[model samples]
Target: MEKNTILEQLRAAKAAHINWVQRAKMLISGFKMEEDAIPVNSTQCKFGQWFYSDAQRLNGLRNNPLDCMSEIEKLHFELHDIYLNIYKIYYDLEPQGFFSKLFGKKKKITDDSVKLAKEYFASMEEVSKKLVNEINLMERRIVALPDTDLETL
Candidate 1:
């Protein structure tokens, strides 16, 4: 939890989120990825893992919890919720056991479905921007603190 360490983790988390968004766009573009690769859960993705774990120690950044933390969490969850919609549009390949692959038809990728997924991604980008800004705000606030206080981190 050193100040610079926290800042680096924050930067990595933001990059992780950006990568996830790119994967979603790839899905919409028809290059479907496997489920294990890109997690769709709010609390399971890479950034989510960092947020709930390492970022928890970031709480008492000022003896008062960082307000930006809550905002980032909210936006993070919203971003995943939006991603769920996009996932369903493309990857809802319902498992009907072996027969699903043998007989079940792939869901036709409709123009409308792609359009909708792209729209969801657009929303995610906006949410991601806000999330990044809040993270930057937190970084700035922590950097502004005295090194003695940061040492306590």
Candidate 2:
């Protein structure tokens, strides 16, 4: 990929993550969204898709001593781990009786769980900030490389 193309993809991935955090905040704020809007798995999100697919092939992001890709992956997983806690708080995922499933019934989420979810959200936000920083650091490394290096990506 050309340097500009790679950079553009990076910007898109960053935006996806930022939008993801915003959507998560919106959910915590009591707005209803499509269930799939905020995926619980780190690897399921758009940013994760891009990071996993493109990071290894990108010149500066892989096979380098100063590579922070692993750190980025760790932080991304931590963010999702925190989100899983919040998701559990908002949903009663235990198996339901056949009748309940047939009727499309769900166990009601409790107010206490809502409060707990907020606490988890705060933790997720912290991890998200670190993830973004690592991504920025990776971007700087990419930009520092000569155009010749970028050409091979």
* Sequence-dependent TM-score of model 2: 0.87
Tens-digit lDDT track for model 2 on 42-110?
879999999889866863534563368889888999998888887776655687788876886654667
Model 2 off-target regions past 4 Å?
59-66, 94-106
For model 1, the local distance difference test gives: 0.81
What C-alpha lDDT values do all the predictions have? 0.81, 0.81
C-alpha RMSD by candidate, in order: 2.4, 2.5
Which ranges in model 1 have alpha carbons more than 4 Å from their true place?
93-105
| TM-scores of all predicted structures | 0.87, 0.87
State how far residue 136 of model 1 sits from its true place (Å): 1.2
**The 10-residue segment with the lowest total lDDT in model 2:** 58-67
